[model samples]
Target: MRDFLPADKARRERVLAVIRERYRAHGFDEIETPVMEEHGRLHAGIGGDNEKLAYNILKRGLDAEAIRAAAEDPAQLTDLGLRYDLTVPLARFYATHRGVLPTVFRAIQIAPVWRAERPQKGRYRQFVQCDIDIIGDASDRAEAELVVATLDTLDALGLEGGIVRINDRRALDFMLDTFGFPVDERPGVLITIDKLDKIGPEGVVAELAERGAAPEAVEAFRAFLMRPQTLEFHPYGERQIRKALPEGAPDDIVAHLAGIGEAVAAARPSTGSGAT
Candidate 1:
């Protein structure tokens, strides 16, 4: 097994202390949950090949009798699995603890999550996921708040050159419709386009073509994705620029962001708290 020396452990603990302090000041309550959970609920909300990566567990006693009866049955050996991400488990937790939780429950969970996958530098089969999420509100304000808080956390962590790339799934869908992509194919298209950063424009085009997208549609998608970030918001209306932001933006975007900034400033805990 891998082990960290005393000095390394102290440094890690110090970083965690800074993160906890910053998150708590912003009204995020810390909560803990089990590392292993039922696979069904985890895959229900976020369905993808990502689900297959979860580390399935086979406890000896619970399934031992069934396995013994079958002698060589593969199915009897595995049932429960490790959590893939914090979000799904958080959703299940919310549903279970709805009555006890507040109207807007802001939580910070820092825990190790396991995934069955090939690992390399910076990527691990088992790693820690630090997430702070606010649940129960369907408003865009909640999303904006979450984003801002994430930025705050990053700033606290002393990380650099980090940019919080924000995109609304709805907005992307709207853009897809605008460019004549079918609604049914939009998710696939977005998933491909999302890889634009990792893979170049040509890579995206090739993937789209492989998915049976017509050349013209693929060209159009390439054009749309390549468009410069010139989006502007005027929240109040066309005439009055609401705090010099986009018109269709959620009313609380600016306010929540400002609040996060204020909270960060008040804490003045560290230089690495803000997001890129």
Candidate 2:
């Protein structure tokens, strides 16, 4: 974390003001959450591997022996923790206030969060995060609205060349089904796929094989990955989305994301001209 001088603080606040105004204009109401949450809730396997980065807050009045014993297991002594991200706390907030909230809640959260990290030039142990979430809406329109709002915010901030990469779990499941991967194994397979950028395609296939993934499924995925890639830029459109994916991608999933792309393009014409 770094201290902000008067000028810097003012400039930061100005930018945040724009973000808040844009988000509110899009119908997302802002809400505040405490910086701390119960330790058990923070580490209940919901935050994934990021849970390891949480800054635990020790319970008051713990003696020396108790502190040492709790070193190996933080949950033993830490009753609360500094939030690593906004998601967990938002979940708790919704659960506690669901009755009073509207049928569908559009939330805007802008706050500082802490994480234990090997800090470097741009990475920090603490930083401000801006998030917008729509709760209780399961329709594809929800997804479209989110994308459109984000792109609109980027436009509002005068930040050029912003793009979003859509990742739909439904589409992923359909692709996995086509490859013949079993239901129980999809999670592990997805974990490996998440590492594709860091490990490369060959490394991903190797790790998948090592994990005992279905051989036929692995071979099919490998072939899909090995297929010749075009160096062409695909503009935002339904056909373009299908062209970027492997064969047998579900029509509904493609249409769902295509709808989002179209909505974003309509909101900001120049900003929607890229491929992922």
lDDT (CA) per prediction = 0.67, 0.85
Name the top TM-score candidate: 2
TM-score of each: 0.72, 0.84
lDDT of 1 by residue, 140-258 (tens): 46655665566666677877633454454544554565566776776677777877887899898899989876667777877755666544321223223232332354544444444
lDDT of 2: 0.85
Report how far off residue 133 is in candidate 1 (Å). Answer: 1.1
TM-score quality measure for candidate 1: 0.72
Angstrom error of the Cα, residue 242, model 1: value is 15
Which regions of candidate 2 deviate over 4 angstroms?
68-72, 178-185, 188-192, 195-226, 231-236, 269-276
Q: Write the per-residue lDDT of candidate 2 for residues 207-259, one digit (tens) a residue.
A: 99999999999999999888886644534577777776778788888887777
Shift in Å, residue 154, candidate 2: 0.9
- C-alpha RMSD of candidate 2: 3.1
